[model samples]
Target chain A: MIEQVADPLPQTGFAKVVLELEVNNHPGVMSHICNLFARRAFNMEGILCMPVAGGERSRIWLLVFEDQRLEQMIRQLEKLEDVLAVRRHGAEHEVFERLEDFFH
Target chain B: MMQMTGAQLIVRLLERQGVRTIAGIPGGAILPLYDALGGSELIHHVLARHEQGAGFMAQGMARASGQPAVCFASSGPGATNLVTAIADAFLDSIPMVAITGQVPLSMIGTDAFQEVDIYGITVPITKHNFLVRSVEELLTVIPDAFRIAMSGRPGPVLVDVPKDVQNQLISFTDFPPRVVSDSLPPVDAEAIEEAARLINEAEQPVLYLGGGVVHSGASALAVTLAEQACMPTTMTLMGLGAMPVDHPLSIGMLGMHGARYTNFVLEEADVLVCVGARFDDRAVGKAAQFCPRAKIVHIDVDPSELHKIKRAHVAIHADVGSALEALLPRIRKSMRKRWLSHVDSLRSRFPMQLPGMDDPRTHYGLVRAVAAALDDDAIITTDVGQHQMWVAQAYPFRRPRQWMTSGGLGTMGFGVPTAMGAALAEPDRTVVCFSGDGSLMMNVQEFATLAEENLNVKIVLMNNSSLGLVYQQQNLFYGKRVFASKYGAGPDFIKIAEGFGIGAVDLDQAANPRAALAQALQTPGPCLIHASIDREQFVYPMVPPGAANTEMIGG
Candidate 1:
């Protein structure tokens, strides 16, 4: 199956995921990252965009899908006017910090 | 250029969401939300007689049509008045979004005029709450709050947007898409496999369906499972149409007010495969002794509910539809002959049967006739008491969410307001409320709201001269002591309703009963039909607390 090959995907059952952006300085760069996430519900959680490094251009983290047209994703990000390196992490695999029983 | 204020942005968003009507009475604290409304062409605000009545009005709209209803209130007393309606929506899982304008940010901790910690108070009763502090942030949180309140497991959501933030100007482009954690608790494969095994092994399996079937839109899936497994199914009060009354596999309602056969079948089942139903105290009286003969395979969306009641032989934390869908393909086709025969025998032995119409003139007779005439499309609401039981016992509900009353927390005086909510939600449908005398008097002030709106609702009062349920308890358990149950000075209900300028009547005989009821139905606006009944009548087939199904009492 394609799911097993050349892939990494967030195991969430949701068909789509959208990442909210909160960039400070580089609106154009953040827009590019959002564009990358908008193409398809890839092998990774789906869409990802957030202000990189407190919204500064130096902190450019191109949110890319782990198995999303990866070759195409990397090529697209690398070709960006302000090109940045990329890293992949599973969305659902985060360690839960705590759960507070604060039901008032 | 500075963008519009948060209040302005909200009105436009609501318009996009098709929220044409809102119910609320504005005050000092919530003026910004009302002020923003001054220029908007989209939203129409209904000036309520009272904040509590407004809350019920919003609820009525939501229950009427499953569309999320909006309500607004100011801080302090305004917010406090909205509490019961919010709690009502919480228990019933109605899609409602309530916005409370808080005091200025500077005035918050100081308890400025009319300020209260509305968010903290509503945390338990609401699915979610937000204390929005900034205008720029409101552009994002406002739509998210509305979507959250209406999506997933729908319930009431309270958004306390502060007055200062509402008035602040902000440059806004468009609202952001909702940000939800991608993490999802996967369905345990082993648990699902074991559940499949136990279901396959049991000969006398009873599929106990609940509201989750309706919640997940799994009626078709549930029916498939029932047919494949060849098991008889029964529903809780909330689970009425999950399995239709006419289905041969469906044995109607269960528990205290359930049909005789439903209790009988449940008492004798070898395996009880429950779906999406928390074994509430009313459903499982004296939990320790409930269905002692069977193994409980509990399936609920909330994981906390598995061992919260009776121990489950196989506990599954998955959507009932998902679980059943997974298991249905693997289920075998052979029917359990002995078990089927046993359930059939029990059903035949104690089928739900009303007392034969002796005079054709009693309260029960009227209820049966009205229910028959209505033909299952009319919505029925009840105030908690003998009348509530009578309607539940007599009326045949063919649709889920058709009969909306206070189910889990049987709040008295809930009938009229809830009926108002249902009528608001479904303006086209005939909303009928069967209220007890004691319960009707709690929020009788809503009569003016009913008359003002002239909503198409049929209000039927079972005017027994006392708190009928309390009277029943006094008669049954309190050594037959005649207590504070009767009213020497009965307020003329006909005059009270007529005072509100609504069509009103009192039913006394059979020849005129049909004509009066038909006339009431034919009238264009709200009708208050009061039927005086003898206070001594008690609901039958009631299994006393801690008693088994067979130990039923009364007629």
Candidate 2:
């Protein structure tokens, strides 16, 4: 079994932003989205997902640092067939902030 | 309404998609689909020794025909084995559909025998993938798989069907209409106008072609553009045959193993028009410094590739062929005599040096000899390494779809099976696979498949008793500590070929090697022509990895 190690350098200095994704609700939709970020080595700080529009689609909120590769990552995300649309918001968004107490 | 088993539905769908041949291996989980496939009169199945070979064979068919090809495998190891080929197709943008079997849906997460979550595993490598839950999903999933595989920038798609799903019965009102590529994104007229103006006004322009030219069938238009603008053209490895290598405007392949003149020409360019080719790190060494002075005009069907590397002054999101068609009329044709002369002068000063052409014993000479024996009609495929680089440098390819090699992934064991696939698709044309000894051993078991099918494939094995590229890298970069690069002892490849019931010719032992090579290549069935190469030689004009293209070593 492989051992899990903590990240040596935390990305605290960078500014955070929220990405809102409207995706087709399915078993592998999250896998596809998460796989994109994971494979590119982009860190996701926070996430919240719930079904919307009669459960046909799901809304996912991703909190990530504002890195140079963010634009490329969004472009890659838009390329996915199931991802309907992507919206960006400032880190002050309440979606992740509302859940801060649960994490604490 | 028509009622059919899921397996039968898949076979019928594949036939409707115009797939005539499929390469695959059968296992317990996928047996039902095999049964249905066996009954089909329109589709012929080629049995490969390994799942990976089957996957590459499908890639070969897709690459040669410019159509999405299909392959099959069972769950677990069979599915795992196909990952590399799928990744290879994904990187090279080959249109392929891989269907794998899974354990029954109820037993999926229990770690049942021969069970693996292939749908999850392949998510990263495939354009899209599916794990069918019910028989009903097959109707939409099958067509979607083809559309996803071929639409936009083509890539591989995977469909994982559970054992119970294949056995389930389904009724449908009508079969889906035969699928074609999804309509291409509309060409941006404003961007095309801007690009044409840039080309019209630029003093020193270079047309850089990529695999997209071949995929979009826009090679002719690309050549026309180059000639009309008097622009010197360069191709990535995947784009080798996009312009005839001997064309006066052609600058050959550019990048890591590119000709010195080609990189220098790129360095001096005032305008760089990149079509259908992403600026891959291998193609553009140290991206920040590549084409530092040139204004970029990037045209690709995939919108994301634009501004991803070098920022494009004019980024057109549309099919390459459509964009070229739109740009052709608005562009002014000019004979930039001064720029052409400068390019020609650079060519003369830093010409690609092929050391030996008279003797068939040397590596470069052997490649040339083979080219001389065969015409431009022969489809050339290469396993990755020094031999691949040599063939890319030496072969006089004259047309698109004439050369197929694993470019992006640089998969070593790609040559033999892919050549067999090319042969399978185009039975009239002779296919030659240039392979090194190290690459050949990776999928040597495919020799049996080649003989069984009697494909007109000639494997020209360059035996150097070592991983030539690794040895070269070690010698060049690793302080000459050659560990694990050399083989303890080389196998008798001639006997190995004969053991697989294929014909063999040892060029080293031949009295007149060139004549013997010509004779062997000319003969019909499968044959392996073995020639020993010196391990000391390395691919010349190296970029030293992570360095800029202009900073080169020896030629």
Candidate 3:
């Protein structure tokens, strides 16, 4: 049975890893990334997305745990037609952390 | 430049993408698009009773031919109905293009009649979605939709076109050929060498194959790797047909409801080489405990799978076929005789035994009868239930794509329309659908479509008079308080088929169900075999929810 797990990913890890993606700005690109993780039952701790300067592309920052699959996930992200480049960051990456602080 | 309506451009682009058929039901909102489609000789539109059936039919074609299949739906309820099928396609990695008509660009979000934000609703389900605001945007969007649907772990893509856009007259300058630049990045040589080193070093290794192996067309390469390395192999449910079921080194399916021996072998494995598979929770219960001793070497086309559950000692992010091809040359040839013998002993200790294999009145017998009746080349589609699980356990699927089921979504009512889709995709080959009574009723309306089109789909209904899977789950967990699961002696499926002008055989009264099934199989054009099975019969070797694979019950 290969359906997406409705259950949220177990909340335990704190060492956050951030992946910055530059992708073609379209309705479904974000869904593709979210769905991919959802299928694997992986959780995205945080997400930040906005249109780039030309409105032709989007920049997405995905917050996740520092899991082993991170490198491979980046490789898969690079494969999408909408996704142009992916860059990684360590726990100190402020996008999600700052958002969490602001919410707090 | 030729002036044409947006609807005309959409149909023209579909023709360029080599789409010959589309499954859909026209509604008031989508009239413009349907109007354009009405005159197009390039595409044949199969009118489905429900939008969901249309979606699944497209899925069946996609799964059969490995090409992007198209489905159409109008706004609101029509678009919502297609969601389940779209989600199914996404989870299963089926390449599908679902085109839904919006009310109009101006009317969107105004709570217009039959208008819904289909693009927004489909965000989590589709690989990508588009809401075409203007006619000109379609020129690039339509072709891009096809390209996205077919490339890199193919999945469903949606295009929500408003009525205004479809009717708008626009000058079209260029219809560029759909180009998918699928240049896979170079494989990591160091990773390959490391994986080869681990393979050569491990004494008790197991080769684990997943759906990706089948998706990448690396089954032959997988077999070669297994034989050369003398590694015992086990498949995930999705990876059932990755290796021929009878291969000596093939250890059968693993995880929940997996072969008892196969799970034991996995427990004992020193090194696990997983290709084209994510270590799903169902497959590897208690992820940390699974293959604890094994140094996992995971090779897959999708990067998200590696270390998602079990951390890999070496992870290669490349297509399964290419990864295996590169690693095959680097690894040494040696037989793990002791490991093979250990696996053999495990197999002998807990061999698979389906109850009533000899009796034609039972579920196993029905499964066996259908398998025996159909030709080896027949494509089998199944709905979600006990029947589906039983089919997985008993069916001797020889190759990939031969066995198509909703693995990820576990969607019911998938069998009938998908079988029709498969039959339509490969008109020469026979298509068989194994459905339970509960699942069959979900999209029972499609039976008419099957009859009208005269599709070469033979449906074998396992009428147990209950939601067998739900009933089984209730028995296991809810203390047998069967709630809303039991459908007592439902409608006569044979009569229903006859109503649709399709041929049918009732095996309930037949003295020999196997013979009756064989007769039904040979019957021409859209037939149904109604086989009544014991409601109490349960699928065996079921691992309780969250239980380890080794802790399965009732084999």
Candidate 4:
């Protein structure tokens, strides 16, 4: 069997951005979202998820580099049936900035 | 108020959705559903030898009827076996629903016997998937599966029902209403107007059709648009039957293995109207170089596809049928005499050459001979490889949904079972599958299903005793170091067909091959017509992988 190794460290040059997504809270929703990024080899630097709308929907925040394929990635993410809405923000978004110390 | 087990409710819901036939195999986990299906007079179950075969059979029905079809499999290996067929349907955008029986909800995470994570496995492949947590969820999940499969861009969906859920009793006042496709995404009138203006203004515009045309049932409208605008039209492989190959404006399939003149026409196009077709790598070689000179007008139902490849000057996000209907009134009739004459000149210079079209023993000849025996009404399918490309080049497909092949997934074992599915859906039409020797063996076990069903499906076996496409690629690009492509010894396919209780004929030994072929096809309930093609014969007018469409090797 072929062994899958962890993805190498993301290339350092590109600027980072944050993506906020509203999704249907369900068991496989995370799998669908993660599979898209992994299959495309698009790296996600940091991620967070929490239920909103009275536990009916989940909000996910993703921190990643703003590369050429980012626009295409956003379009793909929006295509997911469970994904209700997607909002893009620059690195200044407080959602990830507040959690920076936890990662370190 | 009505009360029923989950399995009984599933059967009733499927019947309400107008599913007359289901292809599947019953196993331990799926037995409850099978038992429910057994009691239904409206639905007929086709017992396929393999789960993969069952999957392709559902695909075949969906491809032929343009409606979502269903297939069933049990847990573990049964569900695992179904992965390829589901993937094939997903890539081709065929509407299908695959229901698999899982271990009881409690045993899902544990390594229970005959259990697999099919819902998770099929996530990347299906339009959507469901893991039914309760009997109540079945009411919503079943209808939702059909809705998701048929709405917008059609694709396969999976509903994984735990064995316990199948047996669980649920009470509801009434069943949910049978589903239909979701309302189409609103069309951008401004984008449509701009696209029309570009086509009307450009001197040399090519209309590129894809599988979306067939899915939207807009083939006639597409042909009309091509004629009104005096544009030469080219089809992707999946879009073969959208325009009759012999039509005056038709340029045949474009890109890899396309006729030399067809790609040349695309090279000179001032504007490209790409409708309902994604710019797949095989269809558009080297994306940056494809239609470099042309401004693109891309119309599709999927918003993600509009600017994904070859940015569209005017991107219309709507149903192909609706978008074409809007554009027809805006387009002006033009003679395009100079451009047509240029195309004609190029066509005469570099026509698709068929070296051995007269002799029934040769590859091209065999495809032509089959076409001669059958009319445009016959449904034609092919397994992947040289036989598939050869048939794509030579077959005279004149109508939409008349040609079905694995275009995106290119699964090898697709031909036989899919042909059976088509025959099952449209029992009146004679279905023919053009299969290579290697592809035939992949799902040859399905011959038994064909014999049992006794549908009119003919298998035209092109026996070369090798994986022809790989051998050709090795010869052309890999310095002729052919490895593991050729068979050292082959089975007697004639005896194998007979063993499977289907009639077989070997054209190699026939005194009159054409007469034999015609007889087998015309009198076919389920028949295998085998002809031995030369191992050396290669599908030509080939574009080496990643090369521009203009850089072809041989014909």
Candidate 5:
């Protein structure tokens, strides 16, 4: 039987902003996006990536803190060679929330 | 169409891309590719002492020529060695195509000898990576890798092929027609209009430029806009040489280790127009409080940078060069006399006072001497350390691509190899590498490659006899308990250079350091000048970690 325990929760209670990106399917595109975040020590709470259509392009959703840099990051994402478009969603987007529920 | 091995296709595709050089080492898995290289004379191969050296050498060439450069390595250790250089290229936005040989497909995930999941390993580091399952993928992958690397926000892309794939015969056809995507969404008219409104209405506006201008080749347009609008400009570390250092509007570098005046001006700005610069913490310093009053207008080729750190009032997502060109006619010509005067006063009041300027032995003094000896046109590459900061502070880089440094990764030992790459790319240009005692040790072996090539690359070694920057940080933050910082008395750098078959000189022991350096700089081949300074000397004007741009310790 599973013991009753208080599972750890993140303390920073920062609002999560989810960014949806439509990009060309390629090897380094994800690395480029992640590298930008990693270089700044910006943490991504959740990531959802899938090939859409005939796999010529991809759709990616990044869960991150709704910090001041969010808007700027969206701009940078749009500039990537393969990135086609980007859209922002609030915490209520439920993409990561649903994933959490599925995992739990 | 002719039939050829997959290895031949690799050479042919590189030839199509006009790749003059491939810097790499041959190994077990990559032998087939080397055999193909032996048959080709159009694409030159530079055999570096190490894979990491090869990577940086490719970076040097790419950075200098603004063309995608190539590097190759075998699987496992060789592939891992190229990782540092690949990561460096990624961070700095240098265009490079890294080719690595993987074990045969049958050995996949079996932990075979000399095998590594290089494609999986490089996923996080490269702009893209490909694991070829068949020889056919090379035809599309090679050209696509070049296109991706050279197109928007240029970076390193990896193409890892298995031994069997390289050996497999494939039909060699005429080079694939280059893929051209005119996919950049047109510049938003309203956004451009809004940006103009902000600039026109604002009393104090500052043009903040980054390496984007260099990558986009928009320096001239950026300068034109700044001058046309009468806007004062400041650059990020990566943005140095974007504008002439002596230009009236050019306020020099901003953020950590920035000139006292530049940071103050950024703080004082009403509208901060950032182009091709992500608001890096080092540049912004406490982002929440950074330029609190300024309405930021960030212009970049990438959409992700806008509002990433500082919220932008107007975000223009387009090629930086095109955006500036379009914005030029719309910018209202207005005078910012008061703001200009204030910036001038800040510069005059808190002038950069180089320590030990009278004595030619200090880091700053020697850097100044070197600057005086070389023209503004000379390319200066630096390894990360106290010496790097000193060069940034003292050397007045007059043009873009003139100064190359590991800004993002702060990689030590990047100097010699990157300088070698740049020297090879532009044989006519003078390439000077500034390195510290600790940093030089990291890639000290590259001296052999430099000597072998006999490339006109000058290495000015700032021997502090310790890990100078780390020691400074420890002294300031860790209560001065020196641990693994000082090298006591460092190795004889002159002897080391001579051992590598490169000419050498010791500034500390030299009767005339400047004259000795001048002679070395003017020399036709690779040379090393060891300038010894006190280990106790620190990189001052230090912005303590997490501090604001205005905050500083000592200069």
Candidate 6:
């Protein structure tokens, strides 16, 4: 759990971030993301997402590693197009939190 | 009026256009161009081991540097050798200038020694081609050839200079008017706004990124619109590197081998915002069933692609980045928590897992480890086979333009040759290739080019002692009736590679597979990491020919 520190230097060692999406809300989407992370080598610790309170759409969060070659990293998230705020929340990122191993 | 040579005029034109290098093979007809190169200070001519490799090398440089690169070949074989690369560059939309020498102008249509219809052979593959007759025309046409190649829907352009033209050097002069600025049509504003409004109102949204994103350099805007609108995204094979792997919004790729979730997500989306992606059959399996439910919003710089396959609910004619910028602010942002969770579940369920590699030296284990180690930043070029599919299905590709393949053509012998281009474009970046026994054999001659050009390409040959993919197809579809899909009675690839002076390591004997890979990757010159794979292994997640996109078989 990376605590939200005051304006840290964008958590530099290969920063890891997550975005929870609910586009398809099926078993297949998560597999796609997992396989995607594996292929791209983004070690996702866990993805704790499910049907939200309203249940009209789904939510998904993926953990990923990035560097200054980071624009493409960000582009990958936005490409999902269903992603709400690909909030960079993880280790060596702007926001930090302790996530249980639900994604594993 | 003074007598002048076309080669001298060409040199002057190329100098003005900032062309510093030319990939070529010296021969009988092109000696004048080579002769013209002796005293020139600006252009560096690379004597390629093969003229075909020369074209690919130039294509590679052009693709990487975003500048028009040049290749030269002599008459007959030299000109014919460059054909494949020229066609590839044409389809891939790489900016290249191919200059082939012909027989003396006096020997027209006589089939003189070392004379071939180089210009005619190249016309179909090039954006534009010219058969030079006079030295006077060289001053303006040489620079114009380069200009046309680099501008609009960038592609290779050919200029066939006759042997006589190269010998007659008139006084060289700078020709600045050759480059045209307003040659192509301007972006259509009505179409752009229609796409933006559709996006602004959509509930279930997804964006399909393609090679156009990379071509337009609009990757940043692609991310912006997807994030701002809470849209899920997928990419075509050519669009692999537009984003990086591991972006949460990215749902892998969409194609015959694309992520199951991607197909399903697009299937359900209300508005599919397609940016710079043509609905190629490879990317959109059966066109009818592809995104059947989504109201497609197609945008591309090429107006023709709008209704080429799937008719767009809203079609836009603008570059993706510029379009995204124009449309981003217009779209209302909403909290689609439910939408997010649904895509997340799809991501979790159909995880692309390969058979676990128990041994380090085994092909299965090595590819998985290498794929995992290299992750997203690494660009992998593959020769077609079980290995290529294995990489396609099992690997995660979140970024656009990350995966480059002859998707539409599926040409064999493309891996190493294309890798030469990919490596040259990004000299500092690592370019890895997965070649099969059958696939590597087609273009084995590329080894000399890889070495001579000094391109950094790491090849992982999945030598199954057979034509693995063909065999797998036969076994599955033809009841294992083996025909010509055997490679057991052939030259040993490692030995063959060694003959070309490239490093080779058998995956069987290598003690530490990962270490061997690291060492090979560290090697500055071209190297082969041959991993003998299971000949019986078949590609999974395959939708049996003519079956629905959802009916994918194998894990």
DockQ for each numbered candidate: 0.02, 0.35, 0.23, 0.36, 0.19, 0.01
Best-to-worst ranking by lDDT? 4, 2, 3, 5, 1, 6
10 residues in a row with least lDDT, candidate 3 chain B: B176-185
Candidate 3: segments with Cα more than 4 A from true spot: A1-53, A58-83, A88-104
Candidate 3 residue B28 Cα shift, in angstroms, is 1.8
TM-score of chain A of each: 0.40, 0.87, 0.81, 0.87, 0.82, 0.52
* Model 4 lDDT per residue over B118-196, tens place: 9889999998899999999999999999999999999999999999999999999988999999998677888888998
lDDT to native, each model: 0.73, 0.93, 0.87, 0.94, 0.85, 0.72
- Which residue runs of candidate 4 sit more than 4 Å off their true CA positions? A1-10
Fnat per candidate, as a fraction, reads 0.00, 0.45, 0.19, 0.42, 0.26, 0.00
Task: Name the Cα RMSD for model 5.
Answer: 5.1
Candidate 3 vs candidate 5: the TM-score winner is 3
Q: Please, what is the TM-score per model?
A: 0.79, 0.97, 0.91, 0.98, 0.90, 0.78
Instruction: Provide C-alpha RMSD values for all models, in order.
Output: 12.6, 2.9, 3.6, 2.6, 5.1, 20.7
Tens digits of per-residue lDDT for model 6, B311-339:
78887776666677778777677667788
Residue-level lDDT tens digits of model 5 in A47-94? 889999899999999999976556656655665557788898888997
Sort the predicted structures by TM-score, highest score first: 4, 2, 3, 5, 1, 6
What lDDT tens digits, residue by residue, belong to model 3 across residues B306-425? 676777999898988888999999888997788788789989999887888767678987788788888678999899999998888888888988888998899999989999889889
Native contacts kept (model 6): 0.00
- Residue A14, candidate 5: alpha-carbon lDDT: 72
lDDT by residue for model 1 (B1-555), tens = 447877887776677777878888888777877988777787767767667778777877776666678998988999999998889887877778898989998888896888898877776577667788788767666676777666645578888988988888878556555433123256677887887777788887889887767766687888888888888898887677776677878887788777777877887778898998888767776566678789888987665567766879888877777787887877788587787788778878887767633322466776776776675678888888888887777777777667777777677777887787777667778888889889888778888888887888888888888988888877876788978987788899989999988788777643578677767776767999888887777877787765655566754
Per-residue lDDT value at B497 in model 6: 79
Off by over 4 Å in 5: A1-104, B178-183
Tell me the TM-score of chain B in each candidate: 0.92, 0.99, 0.98, 0.99, 0.98, 0.92
